[model samples]
Target: MNRIDGGFGWVIVCSAFMTLMLVDGVLFTLGILYIEFLDEFKEGKGKTAWITSLIPGTMLTVGLGFGGIFLSTLVCVGHHFEKRRSFAMGISLSGSGVGIFVFAPVVRILIEEYGWRGTLLIEAGFILNIIVCGAFFRPMQKQSGRTTEKSETKEEAIDLLRCDDNLIYIKENCIPSDKNCTIEENASQDDDVHASKQEIITQTKSTKNTTLSFFSRHFDFGLLTNPIFTIFVVSNCCTCLGFNAPYVYLPDRAEEKGMNKLDSAFLLSVIGISNTFGRILFGWIADRKGVNRLLLYGTSLVICGTVNVMNPLNDSKIYLMIYASVYGMFIGVFVSLNAVILVDLLGLERLNKALGLLMMFQGIATFIGPPLCGKSYVYNLY
Candidate 1:
């Protein structure tokens, strides 16, 4: 079959980019959703909060960890064109950046105009776009060069084998014909060689298949059996555990501290803005300074940010803003670093599975972290 360059390939790339952008934009819009959810569902806070929480919590819990399945699928889907793979991924990732830029202002406007209920519907509409774009994602197919060559060679050999009667000797060498050869006799001999080559190829492939396949194989208890991997998994989970709580609670906390609505909203924006910068900065750092150092630095920052929660000087608005900024910076850096560090330790081949496993743990944290923190703050308020 002829290769399809002009048909589905470009469409698939466009779809992947839009899908990621839409998915991530909704993910980032969680802060807006959480506020609306809290006010709307104050009587059933715990249960309803889960509705707002499920996506990121699932995404972080499932998306980050198991998200490699999609990542690998993307690689396999786009693998045929060597030149386009990086371009495709770059385009896809750019969705997050674009989503953030678009979502910030759009969300601000929607909240101003329609309030939370309308904002929720708009965000839902954005996420639904992923489904529309995803429909266009068909895998690229390359022409089967090996199968074509093998078929042609087999046909030529068969034709030559049938060229003579004393063909046994001729089949052994596949010499076209001699005076001593007959077509029928030589044909059987040629079959033996053809079968032998096919058998060798099959045997080689079977032997090589002994190694584990797919990213998930690494998670098959070997890493779990190791003390170090277990420690890393647990520590990373703890780090992620308390990580997003502050972001969810920052606006509410600002209001509690006697900051006006505009300032509280600005505080939320500061976190979002800082978070975008943190992801970029730490992504670069993780690639260069080693993921381990970035992890340590990021975790320490989270600890510091958490400690700032009990700041004795809660009366200082300027100080509080700085603290929130630093906290956002640290958490954002840590979140990005978590992926790189896990991938680095696990190595690229096994990274996705390992992260998927890690996210299962983080998902639990996502479910528990915010409410627990929020309730505690509420208790103190009373």
Candidate 2:
């Protein structure tokens, strides 16, 4: 019931790991699938991009927003952690790296065996497991204000049916669990809660409130007023803008240079594997005293971006593999530190909404980054 940094917290970590593995694994490997689409459709880079429907932007969006599972899965694991949180988060966030490691080659095989369409179908079915992961995300009984907590709590209620799950104790009132669902019962059981025109208006307002809450809860615009967080968000946007481009371009870039298709695809797996180790290694180091998470995050991104800049320098397959290895390792830090840095920047209380906003911005950049990189190829700009 309580977070002792173990027990169910590890359960949460495992759930987060698997959920993210599905989320990022499938999404990151869109590059392999994109190659299939290019050969199948033979469309321009920019236009074919919308084809991410991971043809470029579409699959990434699907991974990030599909059923709106991305942000919640990310935040829930952190909520269950504290003392060894950096390490726990490292272990959990490494799931993405693991996903990337596993999915790239696996997806390539699926494409070769089944074709892109069948592969996409199989991948969709794979992503459906994210829902199963959500059910395991039992809410923590931490203290917080009712109104402020309602945003995330209600979101979880609607998605997971927490009250009916019987895993949680309902102490007072509805806690946004089943307010309108229980309205009729309330009226029948108590005359003071009579069913009247007021109830109708109340129900209508509640419906409107639900819509507004969903919007505000996920994208709290007020966060921009925090100059520090705003800067962080802006910096994140810029970093992510190019972060995914390598994954999308690597396969095609390799094939263009006459690398074998399987080897080309394996480059992503190299990144994934290195990333897995990097996350655990960096996380372990970050959790130790005297290491600055922000500085660590910046250093990781710097090395990652530097690696990206240097990737194009060598077209040799071995060189590319080396590039993938180094690039993947540092990006692992970026992914693992994402949640931890948010806590350092905004504290735990603001973590949920802050993550939502930050993820949304990252999503926008992600949606545009790869396709633009592809377009550059078309225009001889790269």
Candidate 3:
């Protein structure tokens, strides 16, 4: 199919949405699970924090590093869309927000009824749905055919060059000549042909070597050399240092401020709903002309960071609800636009490599952020 705007692309979007819903949606429920871990394990706050941190850390680091289903789905979606790519990405990523909205209360009820371990087991079963989603990702037929045609053309050209008739024809037609051509001139033309042939062989060898070297690396580290990409990674690391702390701790924070566990869980749902709207809205805005995606992303991050910094000061349930709603919306904007902005910066060709590297850096931040926040809670409590 030659379609780039829709059709199978929408199918890929749905699959991506479902995959992210299962993967990231469950990941965000760590907030609800965090309280359960504290009660059950009774370990140090820092020690227990690892449970929530490592799951996402491993998902981003190891999963993305080795072409995790999430990244693969994204790549599939990218392949299927061009002009509407940002909108598609936004719609797909919005699943995470929707998942958070739906799962927060579900996880809460599960925890109250079945406890954390049973809840986890049930979630594990839900996660298997990703495999079903993976089935929808059919490669584009034209792209595959083009690749085969190119390879076949290369082989045909090689075979033709080796034919005696083709070589004689090339010698007669390609080489500049006169009926009274001197031996010295002929010798010089032959020398030029030999040098050109050597150059082609050397270029082919170098191309093969470069391809092999690229595949040898576990993840592409060359992305780090891109100044724009490097800046993006560093900024992401800084943002993530505090980004997930709110998700993992918001429930506990609500509970500590005198809300019941059920009510506390509802806070995540509030965030999730607003987050869903934010993602769709921002995505639409991103596709319009004259709108800068990076500026939108930065503005959202600033708003989220400010709200999180002020979270401890608010004790009123009404205020907490309002804060959660606002925070959720802005965070959703950042999440939805994150990949889209990268595509804007680097284009689609390097997106997978850039995303993998971005995930690796964010994973490092994920691992560290929660533990530090957990320790902060410990210190503040004592």
Model 1: lDDT of residue 210: 65
Question: Model 1: per-residue lDDT, tens digit, 7-38?
Answer: 55666656765666566555655665666676
Q: Give candidate 3 misplaced runs (Cα > 4 Å).
A: 64-67, 143-218
Ranking by lDDT: 3, 2, 1
Candidate 1 TM-score over all chains jointly: 0.63
RMSD of each: 9.3, 8.9, 6.8
Q: Mind sharing the TM-score for model 2?
A: 0.80
C-alpha RMSD of candidate 1: 9.3
lDDT string for model 2 (223-325, tens) is 9999999899899889877888878778988999999888899999998888888988998988899988889889989998887778778899899989999
TM-score per candidate, chains pooled: 0.63, 0.80, 0.80
lDDT of 2: 0.78
